[model samples]
Target chain A: MRNRSILIISLPLLIATLLVVMSLSITLGSASVDWQTVWRVIFSKITVINQWVEPDWADTTETIVWDLRMPRVIQGAIVGSALALAGAIYQGVLRNPLADPFILGVSSGASFGAALVFALGWQIMWLGQFTLPVVAFLFGFGSLMLVYFLARVGNKVRMETIILAGVVVQAFIGACLSLVMALANEQLQTIVFWMMGSLSLTEWSYNYVVFPIIAIIAIISLFFARELNMLSLGEEIAHHSGVSVSRTRFYLLILASVMTGAAVSVSGAIGFVGLVVPHIVRLIVGADYRLILPLSIIGGAIFLVGADTFARTILAPREIPLGVVTAFLGAPFFAYLLRRAKREYF
Target chain B: MLTISNVYKHLERKQLLNEVSFNVGNGRCVGLIGPNGAGKSTLVKLISGLEEPSGGTIKIMGKDIRQWSVKKLAQKVSVLTQDGLSPYPISVFDAVLMGRYPHLSFFQREGKRDIQRVEEVLEFTGLADFRDQMLDTLSGGERQRVAIAKAMVQEPELLLLDEPTTYLDIGYQMNVLNLVKDWQERESLTVLMVLHDLNLAAQYCDELILMDEGSIVKRGTSEEVISAQMLKEVYHASPEIVRHPKLNIPQILL
Candidate 1:
């Protein structure tokens, strides 16, 4: 009961924080725009109840807010929510608290695809656009199938074997990626930069592709939250408690991996949001996935926005990679949480 | 009522349970007693529908076990496997509330009655004070009691207990078995419990099935099956068979 009330209060508080952070992020870009102007521009764009005269805003400010920063911030929030939701699902399905979105080799597969695109100079576009992200998503999905097949032992797929198989596949893919980078005459720096992960190129087009897919998948996952709780009880007990163990595990793996693949395809394998946000939410909400899933979504969006805000402003104009910023910020916070947590909650 | 006939369980080529058969009547506490490797646990698994029989049938109340869906079977039956630490830090109330899983729809949260049922069971098991405690925070005995509370909330017609008391002091052992015994009598619950301790089995069970080598060697009242000769032959243990002076039941002195 106390937990439920805490969740109730945290929900609105998190929303308020997200709003404040997002508005602050909108105003803190390379362009110097006043806070009131930023708010007016945003409020005027929305289809509010009353009709108002258009605010006389500068074309540059409008372009920067709508074209440049708006999509980036929204994409960051979406990707953050997707990655964290995937991470929470993986942890619950595998019954390992350490499991992350990339534990199944999705990130490695994505990196390999991106490397191939960069090294081969493959301009092969998909429907005349987004060749790299499309390829990356396909490779990530294909990697999941490969890991699943490799992990299967007769009728059952043990979690340990799946994790080990993922590690093996990831290592092999990493070697291939390195070979690509080593052989490429030039564009080596470009490959390395992309491999490090960035959201600088986020646009409304990318958002259009990623948002629906992730939002749909994440919502579908919420329905299975109870099944996820059953699964974490260990397989045999879960089966006895009316969970169709094999079927539930299969569906959850597919859903989580697909979401992770989508996020990685867009964000170039952003790390730590998936790993860190879920842990933080779990600490606050306890282990009930019903609460944990939605909270992780909101909390993840807030976390990445904050992290990306820091990444851009800390250096100003020369931005560090998103993955680096997340790891730098997430690792220390995770460590403090580990120290503060006295009992094993997972 | 539960019935098992010609149940054969084989792992690869090795036989775990070979042609085991037994019957447990309604409201009766039946103890499956045997030494290690006798497949008592395997038989319990088969009856609970956790494992399929190689060549036989298990029927609950008249319907074949295979006919029931997993969820329906869960509603009718509950099993408590050997105690292990819970991987998640589930609260005691929520842990017991999981017993209502089979009864709940996919989107339905636990209703008021469900929570009330859990509260009653927690109180009945003397775990009311520990209701908000993390399951892992409790001692071994308390965790075992939590397991019982979880299972009892299922309101199962048949309860299958696998090694309900393996590592515990005498007080805990009796506390667990006594709770089962009281529930059995009050609700007319059919019990098929696998017990490692011979004396406790002989004391608590209404009927005893002595098993050896994945087969039932003897099945009868405590006095008929727990003889010194049978113990030496089946268990390979030399034990003196005596009587409980107060209850007038057979007791094994090892």
Candidate 2:
């Protein structure tokens, strides 16, 4: 039996593309900093010795590179990777090609929490500009737990029930969020901005808060790639292949939800990356999650970094929302993928 | 190789398997012959540990099914269903390679030995040529063959098959059964399968277990169990009993 040798060649190329894309996103900004200077400032800010020559750039440029653009780009990468991996996990575990990270009401529940905060006007900045995200994570996680419990029949949690429960919870919570938006007067604009999903406000400290949560989840998810493959075959078959279906499902769903909640909390339901990147990766590669998981991680980072760059740069000082950019870029690319490919992607 | 001292399964308000007790000897190709809703598939489910019996126990290789960890049990037992794994982006080689799932530990990739085993099984099942083809392109018979190849790679001691040939054409059905018979004879594999075709079941299985209304109607050789009188009593429809031209086994005429 011959395995697909494509993964070996593609993985390295994809990773190299991610590096270049991350660098290009950093370089494309208004600072007029060359790619070489971006590296120099990046090096100087980190290293204590100051290395070689006095930098030609101003202090404000360094602050712009290190403080603003750098965090935003890295935040895009982190949130993108987390959401894409979450989508892959959901698709594998639920055996639904349409499954996304937020298919289970995480966004609506999260937005409800954020909308509540906006309604009450509580901007405490609890963890260096992370007050809203933290509260949103808590409520998003609560909704996932509720959906889990609601979907349980006897001891088993079937995929159909999970989707149904998600639909119910999302519709119910989305209505509540709209109600919050309606009744509020002064904070409506802030709530609307948060709902549109932006990474502009992310700073060095926000990365410090979110990076570990996502990295840990991603590594743990990679370890379960084989299990995910077995799971996608269907539950009864997974049992025949030696997986404890319910238990593995419990762990995988939690892992996906944690990462999804973390992503949504940080960047207010950044859709399309989670929904589209995994599908594109699966189209390019085969159905194996061992390849899909890691490749989605890299592909997602590149995509979001590139999208965020365009989001900030395309409109110049007036910046489009990140979610709008992702939808615009992702939808047509996916449509092209559907029209061109003769082979079955799913 | 497999033991069922006394097992009872209740799905809803009714008992699916009522005080059922049977033991399958090692290397024996035993056929479960029954009408619809007769608990044949339910028994397979119990042995595979997908659902537990309400009252009794099932043991494979002398250890209780409940006591075995999922991976350990899977290494020893493989279950093949009616609708084989199909219509996915996975190739024949990868789908067959998934049989090695139970053997590999967490964070472990399939090694040279596992790949070698998959190759051997694919060759044995005559699937080496179809190795790279997408699963959905294969016919129903070929899909079942791929499934058997996967099961063979698992190297299970006990193979539980539920309705192994429900959708296959007669020629394909014989091909599938002949493959199973060959594998069972060569490796002394413990075989238990629910078969819908009475004639094929009678020809392939060593001993026949007849079931009706959730109880054992009779258990014996095909000659003893497939008689016209017993068929009418249990099935409420009589079919003419005849002998196979070549093998002298009892067959049916509807």
Candidate 3:
């Protein structure tokens, strides 16, 4: 009962915060628009029935909001929510508080896929456009599968082994990516942009591909939220409690991989949001995955939107990569968490 | 009824349990006594289906444990192993409610009946007030009781406890044992418990199985198993066994 009320209150607060962040993000970009124009653009598009009394800044506002900023914001929301949800599931399955979406080498796998595209210069053959991100997604998911197979032994996948395997695979793939970059001198800027992570290149078409994938995976994960809670108690206990350990684990890994791969395909390698957002939500909502999963989604969206907004305005005409801004904020907080955890666990 | 026949468990090419076999009737409290590394815990693990025996079969209710689905076996037998830490904070009520997971469908929420059962178990375990408390904050004894409460909530036909009182104080130990004894009588439960304290086992158990080197060395009533010679042979420790003046059960002195 109390949980329901907390959810009710928190949902609105999170939505309102995200809305404010979205507004700031829409207004503060290189093409600085007034708050009234931003509001007019949003409301006019939203309520298109009364289009007879159109505002003067309608076309310009539409170009800025619909053509440019809206897709970026939507992309940011989708990617953020995907990463956070994946992180929550990963943490639950491993029963490790520090486990995140990237713990299974999804990012590196995606990087490897991206690198292959760069190395081989295989531009999308059938699909005229939409090449790079598709290749990124495939490679990202493939690497995740590879890492899972490498870590799995018979019926068990130990937590430590999974992490160590991820680190090793990640390092190997990272080295390969660097080698490719060194060879392709002309594509250095492109490779660096992809590596650093950005939302600048996102278009409406990108949103069409990423959003449904994120939504489907997220909903499926939310359906298994309670099972995730059962898993958090430990594998043996979960099995005794009637959970099929292997089946639950396999589904969760696939779902997390899908979410991570989709998010990385669109946003490059945005870190910390996946790792930190779920942890912060856990602090507020306790470890019940049912609550934590949904809360992390909201929290992640708000966090990334706010961070992206700050990134856009803080440097004015020169925009920093969203990943850099997130890392700048996330790295220090992550260190603090590590120190606190050391004190608690050690 | 529970039966183990010719069970052999090996870990890393070393024999952990060697051709151990035992049987117990319905509603009987059977105590498994052993020193450290005697494979008492391993035997319990085998019976609980946590670990498969390398060369033997465990049968519960005349059906081979391997034949029973994990959920079906869980409904029949519940195990409370030695206290282990949980990674996250959970309420006492929710922790105990986990025992009902086997009975619940994947999407089923805990209804009022489930909540009532949890409350009843908490009250019976003398943990009603602590229902909402986080388990990590509890004392060792309290945590042990919570563990017992979790197993009890399963409402199993057979209860298995592994060193349930290891970290408990004498008072809490007695409280827990007495509570389990009362439940055994009320529910007609068949209990298989691994106990380190011989006196407690003597006082509580209907039959005692003394284990040594991963095999059963002696099997009888408390009177038969709690003798000085048996203790000396199995444990390699000399101890005095005497009758309790009030209860007339065997008591031991180290």
Best by DockQ: 2
lDDT of 1 by residue, B153-235 (tens): 99999999999789778999999899988888888998988999988998899999988889899999998998878988987
Candidate 3 DockQ vs. native: 0.44
Docking band of candidate 1: medium
Q: Give me the displacement of residue A278 in model 2, in angstroms.
A: 0.9
Order of candidate numbers by lDDT, starting with the best: 2, 1, 3
Supply candidate 2's per-residue lDDT for A55: 88
Question: Which pairs clash (backbone N, Cα, C closer than 3 Å) in model 2?
Answer: none
Least accurate 10 contiguous residues by lDDT in model 3 chain A: A337-346
Candidate 1, overall lDDT?
0.86
lDDT of 2 at A222: 93
Task: Report lDDT per candidate.
Answer: 0.86, 0.88, 0.82
Candidate 2, residue A343: how far the Cα is off, in Å: 3.4
DockQ of each: 0.62, 0.76, 0.44
